[model samples]
Structures are given as C-alpha cells and as structure tokens.
Target: MRTTRNNNVAISCCSSSRNLVYKIKPLSHADSKRLLFKRIFGGEESCPSNLKEASTDILRKCGGLPLAINVTSSLLATRKTEQKWNEVRSRITSAEGIGSHMKHILSMSYFYLPLYLRSCLLYLTMFPEDYEVQKECLVHRWISEGFICGKDGEDLVELGDTYFYELVNRNLIEPVEVDYNGKASSCRVHDIMLDLLIDLSNGENFSSLLSNKANLARRIRRLSLMGNEDEGIIEQLDVSHARSLGVFRPTKQLPSLMKSDVLHVLDLSGCRGLENHHVRDIGRLVQLRYLNIHGTSINELPKKIGDLEYLETLYVDPGMIVLPESVSRLKRLTRLYVGTGTKLPDVIGNMENLQELRSINPFLQSTSFPEELGKLINLRKLGIHWRTSRSVGSSYKEKLVSSLCKLENFNLRTLNISFWLDEEDDFIRDFGFPRLNSVRTIRLWVGKFCWIAKCMLSHANLQDLGIMSGKIEQQDVETAGSISTLAEFGVFPACEGPVTITSRGFQQLQEFRFTWFNGLMFEAGAMPNLKELALTIPMYMLNYSESCFDFGIQHLASLATIHVQIDCRAVKAADVAALVCVLKSMAVAHPNRPALKMRTICEEDMLPDE
Candidate 1:
C-alpha cells in the first residue's frame, strides 16, 4: 500500500505486487537547461542575467530529474533578484542528491501554490491514473462544484480558465494537446504529482476512488468508479453528499444516484454498457448542471431530463437519435452538442442563454432552425455538418449563409463547417459571402469554393483553414499565402495540373497538404515555416514511362514530417510496387530527414490489374 502519515488515503497502489523494473535515465546537460529555463522564463535567453549563476546552481542540485527541475524553476519564476534566487538555492539540501530530495522540492512547490490553486491541484486526484483530462470538462466540473468564484462582473468560466493555465504553468500538470488558438485543449497530471495529490485528497476525504483497496472512505463528496473491480466496493460506502460522479467503465452497479440529491455532474462518457435505465433517475438530482453521455452505449435521454432545470451543459453522442423536445425548456442551457443528422427540436429560440450550439445539419432540420440560431446573440461557436443524399436546394444554403453572417455580427469566434462528403458546387461564389470580421478560425471543409476562396483571405483574424478548389491556380496560392496569420492550410484540387509553389506566399504556414499531385512542384523558397506536408494523388500519376513525379519537397527547409497517399484503384500491381519504392527513396533524400507516412487505398480489393 502506498501510505502517508496524518490524513491517510484509501488508495491501494500495491508496490510489492506491482514492482516492475524501470531503467531511470537522467537528462543530458543541454536538455536539462532547456527544461529548467523554459519553465522559469520561457527560454534560457529570457532568464534574468543576474540570476543565471543561481539558476545553474539550483539546476545542479536538481540532478536532471524533470520533477525536481519543474518545481525549482516554478518556485523561482517570480523571484528575479539574484539574492532571493541564491537564498532559495542555498536552502536546497540535496547537493546533487535525487531520491527524497525531489519529494521535498515538490512539497515546497505544492505549499507555495495559493490556497485556491492547491485545491484545484488536489481536485485532479478525482481522475484515474494516466487519464487524459479535458480542460473544458474539468473546468466545468470545478464550476459545478463551486470551486470558482470571480468578481461581480467577471465571468466565472473565464476565471476558471486562468486557474487551469496556472496549474499548467506551475507544471503540476502536463499539456497533452494545444489548439491553434494556443489554449491547452487537454492535460494530464504527472505520475509524481498524481501520487502526491491522491494522498492529500484521501486524507481530507474530499473525494474517494472506489477501488479494490481494503481501506475505504464511508463518506465522500466526490467519487470515481474506474473499473469493474470497483463495482463490488460500491455498496460498502455512502455518496449521499457527493457533488461529482465519474463512471469510467460499464457497470450494473450505479450507486446512490437516487440519494445524491446535490450531485452536479454525471459523466458516463466512454462507459461502454450504459443503457437507458441506468440514467432513468438522473433528473431527480435537480441541482445537476453538467451531463456528458458521449461515447456511451445509451441510446436515449430520459424525458425527465428537463426536470433538471439548472442544467447548463448537455453533451450526448451523435449516435443517440432521440432528443426529447422538452429540452427547449432548459432556459439555463448554454451549450448543446449533438452529432450529425441529430436534428434539434425547433424550439432553439427558448434557449436564450445558449452560447454554443454544436452540430446542426441545417439540411436535415426545419427551415426555421437557422432563423432561431440567428437570434442567439450569446452563441459564440457553431459546428455544422452539411449532409444529404440529394441536394437541399438554394434556400437551405442561403439561410445557412445568412445565419452565419448574423452569427458573425454577434462575434462568433469559431465557424467549423465540415461536410458528410465533399460538395463540389461553386454555390458559395454564386451568392457571395460578406465579411466575417470576428471569426478567428474558418474551416471550409473543401466544397468547391473556386473563386470564393479569394474573399476569405480578407479576414485578418483567420489563423487556420481547410479549403478545396476545383482547380488550384497560382493566383489562389498567392492570395492564401498573403494571410500573414495563416498557420495550417490544406487545399484539395479537383483538377490535375501543376501548381508550382513559390516562396512569395505562405510565410507563416506550419502544416500544409495538397491533394492534387499532378504537376505539383515546390519552388526552393516555398512555405519557409512549414513543418509538415501531406500529398495525395492517384497511383497512375507515378506511372510515367520515362520517370516518376518529383514533388520538390526538399525545398521546404523546416519540413519535419511527410505524408503521401496513393490511390491504387485500377492500377497495375507492378506500378504500385515500384511507386512505393520510389516514394521511399524520395523521402530518404530530403535534407531534413522528415518522418514519412504513406497510405494506399482501393475499394475493389485494391484493383491490382496485374
């Protein structure tokens, strides 16, 4: 048992049973300084000149353990004076020691955290070991549990964002994914940090993990049931006062839902065997504010869902088809996320507090849907998937575009428009798209934008784009590259022609993909900031009698990864085999030694004509 003195935790991490050999390797000198200085001052160059000597001394004592480095650097980030830095360094008793010394440093970092931040950090213990925590989900849970309090005019959610960043900044958690907007989308607690937090959490009985461990907390405020083994331990405890509940795996034992009158969060996401009956009593918890059934086997939400009047966020799987019309009565609901083809009840006008309405395929919904959406002045982000077996006519498209313009006027930050399948109609150009001044990310999942692509370049705030054209011309390339803020761009050309890329455009592009490969060539100065490139084309393009195509990828100075896709339909087996070898050789010759990945696909058993 992993035990600590004072407030004892019930967590059983049987050290003797789980003993496994680990080859602990120390960081090299350069890497250690990079980690330390980057954490403290963004980079070594930015670190204070006067404190450089003290920083080095502290790093030496850390002895290359990342935990030690992070804690020491975080503790000294606010103290810029050399005296304070040296005094802190002098207090370090390790002197090149690594064992218990690392724990001592961690303890200081934990204690140094502001009281509120310490609670936030400790709350992370609710997540299972090695679980990747979503920032939005965690923050919302924190809000539901009353952990965040802001000034009278301040937004609590935004305040919660600051708290999230603080934990990340302090290195108590590691960022797993950072979006183009530069916010960490998800994070995970480090093992050392998790161990420490788990102990603290159990001591306070702030939350409990229902595991196979012998010692169990009878009363708990928050609880997580990770596996089936924990199911047997459920009836042994009481969760009447629990405010948050996270169910990880499928279980017949869903404890105390009827008794948890104050429960604010019910997350059955990824819980495989969850069925309709399991959540039938969910609405009884009138104080509930957040519900996440994503990836669960549940097919429908109980009609009692509307009884939970305080619910603010409702997330369900796209596969769950039945959306109770009574949901329109949820006046406090701010975010509603459903999958494609899941037509929301037309009562959207009732949700005045709605800030994000995900995923309405207007083609499948009533004509009044977009009109209802336009009135939502609070809607800041919209996710749309346009899907249809037959065309939905001009009226549908016109309403969508008009609503988008209205939403933009209300300051929509993100407009994510994806297609069930790529649409080729240049309909957007027929009825021009007016200025979208406030949208920061506009992803046109490549429906033959043709001439319309030029208009989007005018939006100075666009940082990422996925556009498709019937024919990618040099002029289009010039227009797109002119957007100084553009970082990720992908263009799928319907027609095959050489689109010679010149250095004149795309100065800020970091990731680029061009699906039309015929005559595609990269001039030496093209896409200087490009770190990844993906090229997709037919296998026949490489079957020239004289030679295979040369894409000129070597010109990309900063290229770090290369992905190629070959359409193998109706191609000779010999040709496919030869082109595979040729592409390998081409990747090997690149100066940057970028990692290469290739995909070959065919519907008819690969159509190997030979």
Candidate 2:
C-alpha cells in the first residue's frame, strides 16, 4: 500500500504480506491516534495536551502505517518541545509530491544514524525479513564482525546494547520480549526497514544474500544463505571473500572451506542436511570465532575442533558421542552450549576461558568433572540438570559442592539448577551452604521446596529467584519475602492449594509469577510494590463461580499489568470470555489503572456458550 496520488494516504505496507482472502483495511483514525500516542507517551492519556493536536496530525500524516507511525513517534519521543515536532511534521509533509513519503521518513531515520550504527543496521538485512534475531546472538555477532568495540575497562556487550537500543529508539529494529530486566531478549526488523537495508547493503557490497528471490553482487565479504535453495546456487556464487556465513535452513549447499579461508562466523544453527563432514574441517578455518550448529543433524564433532585457537563461542548438538578430548586446547573459547545427554570429556577444566556452560548434566559426568569445573575460575553462568535417576558417588558430590563453592567465591553471576527426582534428599536441601553475594539471579528447582531457600534468601545481592516446591508451608512464603534486595519472585510450590499472602510480606517485590494462580489469595496490603502479575491456571480444577475471581488483586498498591492464562481444554468459550471481562473490570477499577491481558493456553474441544 502506498500513499494515494493526492498524498493523503499515510501508510506504506504492513509488517508482512499474507495475501489474505479477505480484504484488509488501514487502521482507523482512532486506532492511529492510539498507536502514535502509545509509542511516544506509553499511552494516549499521557500525551501532553499541548502536543495532542500535533501528535494527531503527525499520526494522520503517518496514514495508519505502523512503520511510519513507529518512526514518527520514535523521532518525537526525543523531541521535548512543540517546535521540533512541528518541524518534523513539516519535513514529512513537504515530501508529499516529490517521492514516497514513507521512504523519506525511513531515510531520514537511517541517514541520521552514525557511521558505526549504520553498518550494524545493515548487518540485520542478512537475516530473512521478519526474522526475530536473538539479542545475545546479534550482539555477539556484532562484536565478532568488529561492528562495535569497547574502551579500557568497558564491557563490549553493554556497549553493543547501547547501539541496539539506539536503533530501537530510532525504530530501525523492533525490540521483543522485554523481560523483568527491562532488556529486550530479541528484536525484529520491520519488512519496510529491511527492504531499505538490503538495498543499501547491496549498493556498498557490504554483504550478500543467497535465496531464490535475491542475490547480492560477486564480492561477498559477508554472505547469508536462506531457505532450501537449489544446491546449484552454492556453486554459482563466489564465497572466497566471505568472512561470515549464516546458513539459515540451508540444504547442505555450504561452501567449501577452501573457498572461505578467513571465515570468522559459521552459523548453521538450524540448517537441514548438515552432516558431520561439513564441520569436520572447522579447525582449518583458523580465523573462526563463533561456530553454531545447535539444531543441525550433525551429531559427532570432529577432533579438529580443538585446533581453532581463536574460537570464542562454540555451539553444538551432539547425541551420545564423546566430545573431542582436544577441545581443552581451545583456551579462547568463552561460551559452550551442548545438547542434552551430550557428554563432555574429563578435560573440561582445561578450557579455562569458558565463561558460560549450560544444560550440562552434572550427574552424568565423571568424578574429574567437578575438579575440572572448579578450574573455570572465570565461569559466570552455569546450568545443571541433575536427574536423581543417575547414581553418583559421595566423593563426586563432595567435589561438585566444593567446585560450586569455589565459583561462589569468584565470578559466578547466575546459577541455574534443575532437579527432577521422585524421592527427596537432604543433599539437594544443602546445595547452598554459604551465601553467594556475587550472584544476581538464582533458579533452583527441586521436586519439593527445601529449607535451603531460607539460606538463599539471606544473599545480599540476589534480585531474582524462581523455584519449584512440592509442598511449601506458609513459613516458606514468609521467609522468601524477607529478602530486601529481591525484585522479581516466582514459586511453584504446587500440590498445595489456596495460600493467602498478607500485606506483611513482599513489600519490595515488583513482579510476581506463580504457576497455580487458582491457589493464591491477596490481602488488602499484599505486595505493595508489585506492578506485574502473571498467573497460569488450569481450568478443569475448579468450577467457575462469582467467588472464583475473589483473589483480591486490586489491593496491590502499585499493580499495573495483569497477565492471566487460562487452560481452555474442556472449558467453555463463554467462561473464558467471562473471565476476561471480570479481569478487565478489575483492572479498570484498580487505583493504578493496570492493563489486563488474557490468553487461553489450550483451546481444544472448547465448549460453546450454554
């Protein structure tokens, strides 16, 4: 959709094309107004009275296009005075007859970007349009590609985040899944913005794309192959100069290492038909820094992996194969991700550069594993899946605990442990002995809540805690609330029901998520600082009645967002709708005027209205 010949139409195109059978119309005036104000002011009611008319006019000029609306609003978000906003509108309105008003808007946003930011923005075009790029993946790639750097004593990841948020502020990319940390875990590029980026990237030979629909020019310094294109395309394109290659859903048409001698990144995360032979020669690419085959069919990693001396991040998916012993030689590897049930060689301790090791089943490792783990003096984040089904020697347990304590004394910032056992053990209860003040987030899940939680609550720096408890007593809840630094808390002490939270607890808690929403009640003064509440309920457990909604949620002094997910299996649509209405009414009645979002977990065999 384009602006009408009269220059009255405000929209460019929707985020994606669906070719719907039914006609789709542009947003209405009211909808446009809300979208514009929401982006700039967070809500329509928050828009300044002085800027109301200007904002509406700007939105009208946007012609109900979300892309245009976002860019316009983002531009205005920084402009505090009336003059700057009107000047922007004048610039937008002046382009009415010259060319695409939308392109002018997007171009203004792009050209305003600094030279360094521009390259990073163009890098996003390598991803298929509408792809949601994980923030961690993108930031790391940006660092590896030399798109961003840090000064002395500055964290590169944090510096890269500033660039990410800047683009988000300029509406070049859309941030997604903003969690309790107030950081976007991932982001999406609008199709409109992507189109501009592709053109710019191709014009400068910045990167190349390989797909059925498009291909960049011959000098491919960075190449991205998307979709299962005919294998012949790989032979047709020249990848000799390529430094980075992202094979997204590729059909095993990977370029030979002989062609890519200086490759820094080889991301075949979800490629199809990617076999062990394809990655066997990874060591030959001595310049490689990031290798991701996380979801590929490649099961056996070649022994040559340890030869990549400069590799910083290695991601693999292995099934019942022994990791190459030589991996310990890659002293530069900082992050390692392995599949479940994947075994690591006893030499893990030799890879001291490792900072993040995840999903490692500590129970399946040898006695030397703990000694090796303790050697990772730089380890910042660790994830362990301890299944009680596996038998472990007492010596191994002692070593594991000693290793964890060693990490606590050092730089372990996040500890995540998941335990699944049919029977309880005192060992799991005593996992946390001394306080880990350096840790900011800790998630421990045992079959049942243990008294160890009281010890965890005593940590000085802990801010986020999530745990699973089988039968949590009222005292456990009280003990949890005693943490002064706690910000977000979640507990699934299921198998027990109908717990009441009085105002005496959670005075500093801001976000609370509970699995069994049906099992909790809120008193008048409960969780005074709480702002966000997410509840997941299983509907078959109880019959719907007027009293079912009497959880006294409105009493939370600062409540602002309520998210309710109802399992609709065998539940009636009318009941779901009825629940939504009551929640909306409650939100409307709250002093903070919180917003309510309702979702049905399962909609199978939904009963009709009676």
lDDT for model 1 comes to 0.75
Deviation of model 1 at 60, angstroms: 4.8
Worst 10-residue stretch by lDDT in candidate 2?
3-12
Best by TM-score: 2
Candidate 1 per-residue C-alpha lDDT over 1-610 given as tens digits, one digit per residue, 9 for 90 to 100: 2333222222233445334323457787788899988877789999868887887778777888887888788788877788878878888776344546776677678877888788888888878878999998888778777788788756667798999998887778888766434569889987777877776777777777766242253567788888845455676566778888898777766785778888888888888787788888887888999899888877788888888899988889878765888788898997789988587778777888888777777777777877887878777778776554466777767777788888787757776655433444445555545566654555555354554565565566677777654555666667778888888888875544458779888898988877755567789999898987887867554444314367687899988777888788777777777777877887789898887888888735455564
- Model 2: per-residue lDDT, tens digit, 347-446? 8988887888887888777668888899999888887776644366556777787888898788787776565544545565655445656556666565
What's the true lDDT of residue 270 in model 1?
A: 86
Candidate 2: TM-score? 0.85
lDDT for residue 591 in candidate 2, whole number 0-100 = 81
lDDT of 1 at 417: 59
Off by over 4 Å in 1: 1-22, 27-57, 90-99, 152-159, 178-183, 212-215, 228-230, 235-237, 388-400, 420-429, 438-460, 467-485, 491-495, 514-520, 531-554, 557-610
